[model samples]
Target: MTADGTAPTEEVGGWLDKLGALLRTVGLVVAMGETSLIARNIREPEGATAAGRAMNPGLRQEVVCQPDATGVPWWFWVWQGPTRDAPGELEPLCPAANLEWAAERITRVLAMPEGPP
Candidate 1:
C-alpha cells in the first residue's frame, strides 16, 4: 500500500542477497538467522574479533525488511536491548531497494574500533 494501491514489488530476501554479496566480498560474515522472518545477521571477519571480548563479539547487526505505514517496505536495523537478548529499538535505514546503501551504513557502524596505538 504505497502512495498507490499496489504492494511493494521487492522481496525481503532480495535485500539480504544484495547486502550479503557486498558484505561477504569485504570479509564480513553474512548469515540468514531466521529465514521465515527474513532476518539477516552480520558479523565481524574471522580473527578480527577483539581478543578477550564478550562471549559473542563478532555479531554486528541484524537487519530486516519491514513495511512502512503506507505498506512500502524499508530496511531496518534491529538493535537488542542494552544487554544481550533484551528488548531494543527499531530504526529504519533506507528503502528496501537501497540495499547497497543499507549495507554501507552497516559497515560503517560495525567497523571495528582502532586497535591500541
Candidate 2:
C-alpha cells in the first residue's frame, strides 16, 4: 500500500501480470481496478451491432494481505452477501502467489454451456 493505492509487493503485481496474459488469450479483459485487479467479460448484448457490448463484472474479487507465520500472504478474496457493517463477508479465493490455480478457477466462470463450468 502507498499513496497511489496499488499493492505494495511486486509479487502481487507479477501474479496479476501473468494471470492477465492467460486471461487475455482466452478473451477476458484484465486491468488494474480501482482497488486491485479486475477481469471482466464482454457478452453479446441484446441488439448488439456496431455498438458497445455489455461489460459484466463477473466474480468481482480483490486482493488482500493477511499475516502468516511465514510472512505476509497476499490473497484474492470475494465478498459473499455483504452488508454495510459485516467484516465477515470476505472469503479467500487463492493465494496471490499461485496464479495457475487462480487463473483456472477464476476463468472457469467463463466456460460455455457445454464445457466444464
Candidate 3:
C-alpha cells in the first residue's frame, strides 16, 4: 500500500528492460537512467555529428514512467523543453495502463525515415 492508502502499482523497470533489449538487437543503444530511458542511434561514433545525422536525423528519444499525484503510473515521451502554462507541445503517446504499447509506438516512430516517404 502507498502512503495514500492505495495499493502499489507495478514497477516499470522490467518493461523498460525488455524494450531496451529489443532496441539493442536492431543497432540502437539504450541508456537507462534513474527516471528515464534514452534510446539513440548507435551506428555512428559518439562525437561524429555528421555521421550521426546521416544515420538518424531525429534526435535521441526518451521515455519517462512516473506516477502522478493520484498514483496512476503514466508513460510518455520526455519533452525536450521547459514546461509552460499552456498545453504541452507533445501529448502522451499511451495511457497509464501499458508501457509496452507505448514503447512499440516509439520504436515505429524511430524506424521511420527522416524525410517524406
Q: Which stretches of candidate 3 lie over 4 Å from their true place?
A: 4-10, 43-58, 82-90, 95-97, 112-117
Who is ahead in TM-score, 1 or 3? Answer: 1
Instruction: Name the TM-score of candidate 1.
Output: 0.66
Report, for every candidate in turn, its global Cα lDDT versus the true structure: 0.63, 0.57, 0.63
Residue-wise C-alpha lDDT for candidate 2, range 1-117, written one tens digit per residue: 444554556655666667778777877777674335666655444454553433442434344434233454445554545676766445566666676777777677655443333
Ranking by TM-score: 1, 3, 2
Worst 10-residue stretch by lDDT in candidate 1? Answer: 33-42
Candidate 1 Cα outliers beyond 4 Å, as residue runs: 1-10, 34-56, 82-88
List model 3 lDDT by residue over 9-84, tens digit each: 3356655666677777766778986545788764443455776677665547887666655666566677656656
Comparing 1 and 2 by TM-score, which wins? Answer: 1
TM-scores for the candidates: 0.66, 0.57, 0.58
lDDT of 1 by residue, 59-108 (tens): 46777676766677777777777888787667888887786787788777
Off by over 4 Å in 2: 1-7, 45-72, 84-88, 112-117
Predicted model with the maximum TM-score: 1
lDDT of 1 at 81: 72
- Ranking the candidates on lDDT from highest down gives 1, 3, 2
